[model samples]
Target: MVDYKTWMKELDDNTKLTQLAIPGTHNSAACHTALPSVQCQGESVTEQLKHGVRFFDIRVGKQFLKEGDDAKDLQVIHGKFPVKIPFPRLLKDVLKEFYDFIKDNKSETVLVSIKQEGTDDWNNDKDEFGNCIWDRYVDKQKDLWYLKSDLPKLGDARGKLVLFRRFGVKDDEKKQKFGFDAASWKYNTTEDDRGRFVVQDFCEIQNKDDISKKVKYVKDLAEKAQKSNDDKLFVNFTSGSNFFDHDCWPQQVADAMDKGGVEKVFAKGCGIIVLDYIEAHNWKLAKALIDKNF
Candidate 1:
């Protein structure tokens, strides 16, 4: 197997993106666990940063309000505030998996999905306003993942190295009309401490059916949650291909259906919502979760 540095260097050179340390701020607390770092060829590495796994340090550039301020009085917190920065934690976990997977095998090939692009539609103020009127409308992922790195360009396997985006939308007028972009964006600035952006609520669009329906569902849910004074909502979309679906996992049937369609359906509900982690060929039922939740 390639050394950790060699693997990282190969990724950097082939991917054309710089490695960055996950940043932090003064107000943010650190993880108690000393996450395992990557090591290869006598060189120890701190992260296994591929192109799709987005990383964000919630402590950098955080914002705060004085006590008793207009924004401070709102207290029915559910999805707002107490933002969840799952990237660093997820990164640590993925790296461990990567390390363990190739423990016995020398130079095992694995897939890495890095953030490629995202929309600049939501900023701090827009996020707050959207939260006021919408349920759990958090955009931290956009900044953390999308605005952080370049995703793998080709889905084809290279030297046992397999990587792809598990969640991505097609670039079409219909998809764009919903205000979700097909491209991922990387950040252009440095770090801060208090929290660059406070996340109210976040969800993945795991649902994989009808696009229009998903849009309507998400908007309606956001509206309903606002009326009920709810804090967060979860949304997700699914991409139906995996290693097995490809040459990596030949036994697996990797196919692409209307994943955007799936996300479109779940996007319609209100309140604190959670769509179960879905699997391939289950888009029909995943879409039905909208009916289950509604």
Candidate 2:
């Protein structure tokens, strides 16, 4: 059995990060308690780290607005649905999972992508999504995260969570410096190359057969990512879904992909291939990506 907890301990520090394949979860937090359409993964963030997943695609929003009760407490969300821990969980609590995991396993680093999910109060001008996080959460525990807009060496970021900020504030300098400038991600794009990184998030799987198209695109992009210069990060999202065919949903899409075309591609480093429901396949694909690094 592969020991995932300290998988990066063997990796070279001089490697320019993009040279390795890092596996990730699409919606890193949504559990089974959420509505089927909203639920993506079956496990918590801690379990994902223990099982070899690295990057986390996270969505945050204000929780109590629809109840006529509102606060700035950011909670995890998958689309409009709140990720449930039986009830909505605070973002700090979800983040604690990352902190705790990194504390015990200092050799490993995790990448987190934070995006403003809903049209809640936090999205308004009064609050401004990015500044709220910077003020309330980031200011308090700045040491635990790597907040630079550029990628760092594995040695420099080993014990911290690398923040890939996808939320925006009014200040251009802050926005530019706020973790790799993914604030305006191009959706369904085959390749959104932003100099330091390239993102391929084709996430609307409209039909059942379209799964093959997504699979091929993910494979092609991941292979392309491997051929790129070491400084450029390739984020190929293999997960996609829509409201139509049940197979187009996260779990079914995951199952189909589990049996699809990733086996050969992952034998070598394939950049960051973001997935969905990683727990369903017993961490097979995630572990495969990690293995390629060595």
Candidate 3:
């Protein structure tokens, strides 16, 4: 297994070293732009750049990489959060390549948000009591289908081979825990607007129920779905654990699907669910789902 812990430590150390080497990069404060009108309250501009915040700003220049194209269409995705990519051009260069592809294709701006282990944004560690704070966050955003803009950087590029080989393909839990974070919410909460994420809550999914057969059931369904399909199957239940009704079987259906080889399974609806445990045992699964299609 790739030591993500080591990698981040190196990256963090190197980034500091690079800043010292550059003699002004760290000294320069990013100019604050206007707050998003979307009505969502997320980490303030300060919070966005907190530990583990990898934002990439990809400018797709005009001109199609294909047979014919026009340069006039070239324009910035303009007026939104930039993509998040790890710093230090050398190690993070693969992300640059991905950004270039997005620009070449003239797709809308693609914001790439990446989270490294051992960052404040993702609580990879457990307290004395143990809990999956990150998984709870993933579960919290299950109801919304984020306006995901796929970037080529996330695709299987040449560099990815080496990175994955050395690092091993990332597990699913990380993706799930942070999938919604990568996405920009369409501000569609009001009557006058279409579906544009207006709110951004960086909280975890607090499972309302306790550890029971439901967790096992969800696992079973995901396992089954994984075996049966070449294309990954993703499902999120709208119901949650009910305290009064032990028969609620909140995740019973999802569990059934997992037993059938489903590639991904998640819970939806409004209610608390345990996030700490999910992070501890299956953070990899959560990450896989997020990275695959958040």
Candidate 4:
């Protein structure tokens, strides 16, 4: 069997990072939740990596252990639904899986896009512990991450967790921050060098009719990226669900796209296609996205 993790080693060192085809999971760790609107994937983080998913969308929030407790820890969340495991546990699990995969196959890298979720005031520079989230999690684990803002060559990021910062940074003028600024790239935005990336976030699915429209919108954005001459990265989201109405689920959206001939739209290439319920259909959708690289 082909090792999808090491496939990037075949590409040239000068290849633009945006030009490569990458498979990603939207709300990657929400599989364990029972809520219909919150669950996005059926596979765990380790399983997704084993099945060729290189990019992960992770949301973290502050969680207090008890009432009036000054101490709090980060927890993974999907909208309002919180995962059973803490953020530190999730990070440890992912790192264990990632290091094991790359120890044997050293050509692959993981990109984690982290955003703040829930109602906590994450915008503050530091928490009650007098330490910023970056200092508590990212800065201490520097050896395991690729802490650079600019896109680098494949050779530079091998066996590393490339940070994609989707949250605000501290305002300290003396300290230098790392990771790609995902907030600068707005939702459903056009591609440009200044933005560094483009994203399609049509997440509202009200009815069965909305599924077809969402799929088409995703395909159109992907096609636009393929035709563009610029090198800005494109992140296409094929996941959508209604929270209040529950009219649609992420798995249903993914199935609709697969059945509606979505694979044919990526003949040229797909930058980074993020899907929900990636383990469904025997991982057929994920394989189709990875096949575009060849």
Candidate 5:
């Protein structure tokens, strides 16, 4: 096995983060969520990490333990569907898995893309539990993470959680607060040369016909990244699901992308490739992305 998780150790410490072809999982912890549109991953977080996935997209929300109960805890949510792991459990169980993996593989680092979701107002400083989710989850765990906003070399970020904040920062005083903002990139909008990275969010795939179009768009962006002189990170998404069609899952889109032309783009070397149902098809797609780095 290639052991893609710690592959960065083989590269020079000065290697630009943007230049590495990282394999990521979209909705990383939602494998247990039963919802069609929400359950993007098929493997647990531990499995994903062991298989060489370094980037994780995690969505969280506050959920009441009981109806009308004042007590609430953070839960992994994808839209209306809540995954099996609660916030505390995720930290104690799911995230701990990553920490252990990194501890053993000192040269490896993990990038987490966390966003607040569900009915609760994430903008509020505190949830009903009177505990600040940001403080407890992110701020307190400073030692385990690499919160710097700027891109860093592989050696600097090794054995830490490199945060990619999808939710807005709460405190103004914490301007240079850890991690990079996902909002830094254009969302579901036209592509343009801006910031230190290039990202395309074509996640809205309503019908089977939309699959080819989205795949082509991602391919074009990857090709552009390969030829560009800007040295910007390219985050391409090969995941989507439609509420109307349960069969149109993220795995299907990923499979389509694999067959359509993603292999060729990857062969020339590419940037971060975020995928869903990474364990499906015996992890063929994820392995393909990792192989590009070799």
Candidate 6:
């Protein structure tokens, strides 16, 4: 087995990120929450990195303003609820952890899937949330990132923060593709041919019976990707929740999947398999997916 932290080093430089099977988390930073419905993962962002999770599905809530050049403090969120991590609420502080990880493990790359989260009625304008991310969080750490719209080879992307911008960008970049172009994805349910990505985020597990169907969806996509996986990115999510039922929360779903055998669900060319409670089943879930890359 390859070392979890530097697993990317084992892949050929000619390989595109889309071609590799990556371990990921649905809500990467919700490990600190006490709420049952919201807390998705058992590991922190940095800890997930050490466990061979390359793709991170991060949601940030825009907060109070600081007029100076300092990066805007963005709250880490899961739906309407706010989450607290070991670090401060500052997005910069959280991002600094990413930077530190990549700096130490230069052969690895972190795929950040960032989405704007919160219940604020206001929408994000060019100057506020978008500018805060592009100008402050991303631009400030320019050398540490890959802001291209298209997929990059493993060699070109090593030791970098590969951006998969889920939110919209500024005015000048409006016409062109920015980051991995995840701006338009099918919500809850997903299509098999979403151009840049093939996603299965069937998060509305209405009942216990739906969990198996969700697992089947993940398996079907994984099998499909293995057959004709080149070019398009496949994101299979093994996490779901129903707000009204405790039995259908993220933890329950994860438990069901583990009991149902998640190892068998993931196959070679599974793309990025996003899970909740990644540390479950003794980290075998993530290790199983990571083993597929070779």
* lDDT values for all models: 0.24, 0.80, 0.24, 0.71, 0.72, 0.79
User: In the order shown, what is each candidate's alpha-carbon RMSD?
Assistant: 19.1, 2.2, 20.5, 3.2, 3.2, 2.7
Which has the higher lDDT value, candidate number 1 or candidate number 2?
2
Native-structure RMSD, model 4: 3.2
> Whole-model lDDT for model 6 versus the true structure?
0.79
Off by over 4 Å in 6: 64-72, 85-88, 121-127, 170-178, 190-192
How would you encode candidate 6's per-residue C-alpha lDDT over 155-267 as one tens digit per residue?
A: 99899999888876556564253477677666888444667778888888899999998888877887787787358888888889998898999999998888877678566
Please write out the lDDT profile of model 5 over residues 83-108, one tens digit for every residue: 66443224335667777788888888
Q: Give the per-residue lDDT digits (tens) of candidate 1, residues 1-294.
A: 323322332332232111111110111112222222110011111222221111211111112232322332221111122222322222233334444443433322333322211222224333332232112211322211212112222211222223222224333332322221222222211111112111111212223332234334434543443343222221122111121112211011112213334234232222222121122243233333323222
**Model 3 residue 2 lDDT score:** 26
Q: How would you order the candidates by TM-score, starting with the best?
A: 2, 6, 5, 4, 3, 1
**For residues 110-205, what per-residue lDDT tens digits would candidate 4 score against the true structure?**
888877776565435543322444656666667767877776677787877787777655544312346776755545433333467878878778
Q: Work out candidate 5's RMSD over C-alphas.
A: 3.2
Model 2: residue 285 alpha-carbon error in angstroms: 0.3
* Candidate ordering by lDDT (highest first): 2, 6, 5, 4, 1, 3
The deviation in Å at residue 205 for candidate 3 is 14
Model 2 TM-score is 0.93
Question: Candidate 6, which ten residues in sequence have the lowest lDDT sum?
Answer: 63-72
Top candidate when judged by TM-score against the true structure: 2
